[model samples]
Target: RIERLEEEKKTISDDIKDVFAEAKGTGFDTKAMRSIIRLRKKDQAERQEEESILDLYKAALGMV
Candidate 1:
């Protein structure tokens, strides 16, 4: 059962890869898309806090 579940997970992962490939073929940026997806997974407050921290760090390093 565990092995079968692992195979199924791999299949789903492959399907995700195919979808990303198709999106890239259609002129979509998969790297940015992945980042957007990750951000969407976080709540507004959490995202805001992360961004604020990043901004502060960048400013500290004169990267802002």
Candidate 2:
């Protein structure tokens, strides 16, 4: 069962690589795109956490 799962995972990974290669052929840098995606997700999460903290602070001060 585990071996089958591993093979499936590898197949999926290869498919992803092929897709990225196709995108690269269209003049896109997959690495840069991936980096940008990672950074945007991280930034969004950080912004959300910051906003949550700000909301808590405001509520503590009876402002909201």
Candidate 3:
């Protein structure tokens, strides 16, 4: 069962890679897309907290 699940996971990973590759071929920003996907996985409060911290760090670095 574990091996089968691992194989399935590999297949999904490969599919994601292919999608990213296709997006890249079309001149899409895959890294940004990945970040958006990651952010979407978080709840609104979690996202807000992360964004707040990021803004603070940017301000500290004078990037903002």
* Cα-based TM-score, every candidate: 0.87, 0.58, 0.91
lDDT of 2 by residue, 1-64 (tens): 9999999999999998898999899999999988767667777778789779999999999999
Work out candidate 3's RMSD over C-alphas.
Answer: 0.9
Model 2, backbone clash pairs (residues 3+ apart or across chains), number? 0
Q: List lDDT for all candidates, in order.
A: 0.99, 0.89, 0.98
* 2 or 3, greater by TM-score: 3
Which pairs clash in the backbone of model 3?
none
Task: Give lDDT tens digits, candidate 1, residues 1-64.
Answer: 9999999999999999999999999999999999999999999999999999999999999996
Per-residue alpha-carbon lDDT of model 3 for 1-64, expressed as tens digits?
Answer: 9999999999999999999999999999999999999999999999999999999999999998
Query: Any runs in candidate 1 off by more than 4 Å, and if so which?
Result: none
Residue 61 of model 2 has an lDDT of 100
Stretches of candidate 2 exceeding 4 Å from the true structure: 40-43, 47-64
